[model samples]
Target: MLSYGFWNNKGGTGKTSLCFQSICFYAHQHPEERILVIDVCPQANLSELLLGGLANGGSDRLLARQGAVPRATIGGYFQQRLPSPYQPPAIEPLDYITTPCEYNDEIPENVDLICGDPLLELQANAISTLANNNIPGTDSWIAIIDWIKDLLQPLSGKYDVAFIDCNPSFSIYTQIALSTVDRMVLPVMADDSSRRAIQNAFSLVYGLKLPSDIYATYAFATRLRNANRTLPKVHMIVKNRLTQYMGKASAYAAVLRSIDRDIEKLMDSNPEIFTFEALNDGIVDVRDFQTTGVVAFAKGTPLYSLKTGKRDVMGQRVTVHEDYKANCVEHMNDLVGQL
Candidate 1:
């Protein structure tokens, strides 16, 4: 199975949201029938999307909100003892559940999700304890990943893809994710600030000395509009509250093309450098996901329809894909092709 992670340090960039959509896309499309979503983000948005609620009520949410204690999450999976093959829990752990179908009956049958606890942020201190030779719990970090690998081993040939949604920071949890992931995708916006975030993400990947195959990215440029000629040329742009500041098409595309050319130059200047795409609006349509996992599930039904292709360059009314949904699918298809 292919293990992929959708990551970016900065928030509000739609990292978890896109990850959820990709899981849905593949679950419906891939037939070999092996898929698992590991939600490492404390935000638990992906987890909630899959399971429909946070584990242990909203306690996890409260803890993450306060940043008080890192939840004894996957850390417990490392140290927490499990029943042996010969024991009661048997081949699979107890937390696994098969509930009634929410979306397509066939689709949910092929899907299984491991949720993230809000207190997962607490794993940092747990890792520190283990590093200092204090194995307070059942296992260590190495044990955690091994346990995870073992848990999924049964579904080995059954799965064709695994999507892991990691937290924003470069903490111990992310380290485990990086070491285990077969590939990684970074989603960036079109603005200068998002560009800096991508740079920081690149730094994180390089710092780990992870193989080149494991690090890759796609840029989803959104909320862009054609404005005056004074602004910088960029590859893509997102429309936001400040409509007054967007540039015109001729000027904006010119700026974006400049950025794209600069990136090509950067890659040529450094062979290890990665490649990126400047996709227009492709985010998911929010209305498609009405009241949880229950979707309309109808053909030709727009997936969260939004305004597109209407207004003129100067503050014209335009509707793009809801939120990078299609762009993510396209980018992931390319990544899968690489594997």
Candidate 2:
């Protein structure tokens, strides 16, 4: 399957929300293709949105999945894999899959989900230990990293495309989640820290311009390359939460331009690690979703499914301006068009 991952080392970058909306729009636009979404974040916010957001009983539904006999979540799949860290299990991969549209009518009919779980936080330490284990005749690290890949083995040719939502940290779970992606869609805000986060992402994923020679030996790129594995190329960068302001003289304009310049310099030096040679070809500027985003996310609804004006969200009347709603859909359409 052609897979894309939405990730950034920084939080508050609107990564999950963007993934939720873009995937929904994509699923709605292409009704013939079966879509899959894997939520690897411990918070599982994306899962909640998929199942039914706060207005609906999403948390309750998620809890039911988490408490199932097989656990019925990614953590449950991890529970199966922990006992056989170095080998694939005999269990069914589709058993862990849940169709979101079955629970929430707002979702497109073709979408399926592997629910994220809070159990991930508890299992992270033990999983890390398993990865670093010194097992004879088996590469513990690669096997651990491939847990998700192995799980998806039976799903080969089953899905037209897949999207993974990762946590902000470089934890063991995040490492496993990222190993399956062919293209990386990084989201960043208009700030200096985002610039640093982009540089950090490059260093963490591709081992570009690592600070010292000693670190190269223990870097992610080092280990993956040693195992003859490939790193996902940077396909596109989404500048999320850009405030609509007074043209190029806005307060965030300078920060955004600096980030672009930094990326362009990196493109010049590490052309092999990016899908696009030019920065403009790979960058998408999205205005803040604002009221439309708040309402859409609150009810587990996609932008395209939203009607302007007052919308009921759990007995609360939330006003969704028509202009704002249309703006959200337009931005999402633009982002999906890139895919």
TM-score of 2: 0.98
Over 1-339, each residue of candidate 2 has an lDDT whose tens digit, in order, gives 989999999999999999999899999999999999999999999999999997787888888888888888999999998888888979898778889988999999999999999899999999999999998888899999999999888998899999999999889899888888889999999888998999899888887788898999988888888999888888889999987773687767888898889889988888988889878889998899988888888889999988788788777787899887788789889999999
Clashes of each: 33, 0
Q: Output the TM-score of candidate 1.
A: 0.57
Please give the distance, in angstroms, between residue 27's alpha carbon in candidate 1 and its true position after superposition: 1.5
lDDT of 1 by residue, 1-339 (tens): 768777777666656755665565566566556677777776666655554323222334323323322222343343343323111123443243222133223235566655565555665656544533435543343443344566566667756777788888876566556545655666554456555665576556543223453342211001001111111111122211112234556554354455455455544554343423323222211212221112212111122321233323223333343344354334444433333
Give Cα-based local distance difference scores for all models.
0.46, 0.90
**Per-residue lDDT value at 19 in model 1:** 67
